[model samples]
Target: MSTPTSTTAWVHKTTIKPTEKFIETLQKQDLPLPTLGPKDVLVRLHAASFNYRDILIPRDQYPFPVNWPLVPMSDGAGEIVAVGPQVKSFAAGDNVMTVFNQEHQAGRHSIVSATSGLGGALHGVLREYAVFPEYGVMKSPKGWTHEQAATLPCAAVTAWNALKDIKAGQSVLVQGTGGVSLFALQFAKAMGAFVVATTSSKAKEEQVKALGADVVINYNETPKWGEVAKKASPRGEGIDVVVEIGGTATLQESFRAVRMEGTIAIIGYRAGPTKDGEKEPGWGEILGSICQMRAIFVGSRAIAEEMVSAIEVAGLKPVVDPKTWTFDEAPQALDWFEQGRHVGKVVIKI
Candidate 1:
């Protein structure tokens, strides 16, 4: 196959405001293909997945600084169209997915090693063609669709990192029906754990149950749902793990819901900012929980490879929202994601 000379991309020009229109900040551009380095492989992206973080990119809400005219998306899967002379692990026609952190291959993460994250400090995978170091991408899981493979990079990897050590029979509490939470539900069930999920929507309670959740709680109905969750645990010992995605708004509840010496994986702050005049949970409460609190920043490529192997072995499929958008409808996809109406993942077909 012949390589294209130019490809289209959605470029974020300035910091977006919550009140401002999302499409206004991002504009389409047809640019020359990026130059390939000695250890690079140019991929022709077939599909890209959206995360909550993708919406934050335009607003510059991500923890990292923005790279101007950024192609803003972390999860994408495609076929390798060309490879540099020094590239040996990948070749033409290899199907692969981009990694969230391009530099952190393995081991513990560091500020320096984590700086090269896609869609933040570095250019992301939104473009039709992107050049990546061979180490930055991994082969997609066997027998998976491009869209399914696309969802693995960010949400799936984060979920895998959170539940890598969880054994069967343990109880886990996952908040919301977002990508990470849904993936957590699936992964925890695969590990034989009892899953308890929280969603504000009563309509989604059955949906969460269908996803193998042993119990579902409507946090809106039960504002202090933590006590209820604790009671639902085996012998009322509290949960073994809490996928804490709500930050200050929900940390207090997590502390209340988790058992002694349990694990809390801090993933995202989708619960919005802390309300004015609202007090955060005191340190005494946090310390009293005595749980292992670890911050998750996606994960390494090695972990992604392991997750993909598990997916292939278990025949696990990502829960993609039925509403898919074309490349031209990228803006709509983002709008839908921002509305927070869909379950699982929202994908863009390239």
Candidate 2:
């Protein structure tokens, strides 16, 4: 394969605060490719996936400051079209996916790794062609399509990251039907854990149970869902892992659901922001539970490779929403995602 002259990419010049719409802020233009660094690989992207944070960036609601006029997406899959002289692991025509935190190769998350996140601190992956450090890309799963592999970089990896140390016969609790929650449920079941899930929709409860949820609690109907999840846990013990996505609104229930010394991997704040006079509830509830809470940023590149190997061996498939958008429909796709109707990862084909 030969290198392309230019790539088509979407850049958000400013936040939606000005235009209050994505079509106005997001612009697609063809531009000349950058000179590939010695360790870089030039790739022709095939697909990209959406996450909660991606929508927040354009709304100026993300926690981090996005560099203006930046390409904006965290997860992507493609095939290498050209490799720089020093590139070794990948060459022309290798299928691969982009890493979410490009600079964080291994070990644990640090200030630097957290700061180097793609789609936020750095230029992101939603483009026709992109150049990444050799370390920033990893091989796609053996038999998966570009679209399937595309969903892994953000939601899949973050779920896997949060699900570490899950063991057979243990119990895991996943909340709602979002991308991360769905992945966590599947992985937890694959790990031989009894999976308990919470969702408001009656239809989603059945769908989640079909996805191997041992028990599905309707959070709206069952206001004390954590207690219900606790009762449903394997051997009737408390949940070993609670993938806590809701921030303030759900913490008390999570405290009720978790076992002593268990982990609550804090992933998202879906319940929205705290009010001016509203005080965040104290941790007084979980004191007896003695649970540990860890904030899960998406993992390092090493973790991505590890996850890909696991998926290949276990044949774990990511759940992508059926309504796929073409490259030109990115703006509309974002609108659809912001509406919160999809059950699985929303993907756009490049």
Score candidate 2 by lDDT: 0.86
Per-residue error (Å), model 2, residue 293: 0.3
Candidate with maximal lDDT: 1
lDDT scores in order: 0.89, 0.86
Against the correct fold, how does model 2 do in TM-score?
0.95
Kindly report which residue stretches of model 1 are placed more than 4 angstroms away from their true locations once superposed.
276-278
The alpha-carbon deviation from the true structure for residue 72 of candidate 1, after best TM-score superposition, in angstroms, is 0.4
Query: How badly does each model clash, as a count of residue pairs?
Result: 0, 0
Judging by TM-score against the true structure, name the best candidate.
Answer: 1
What tens digits encode model 1's per-residue C-alpha lDDT throughout 197-267? 99988778988998999989999899788889999998698999899999888888888999999998999
Would you estimate the TM-scores of all the predictions? 0.97, 0.95
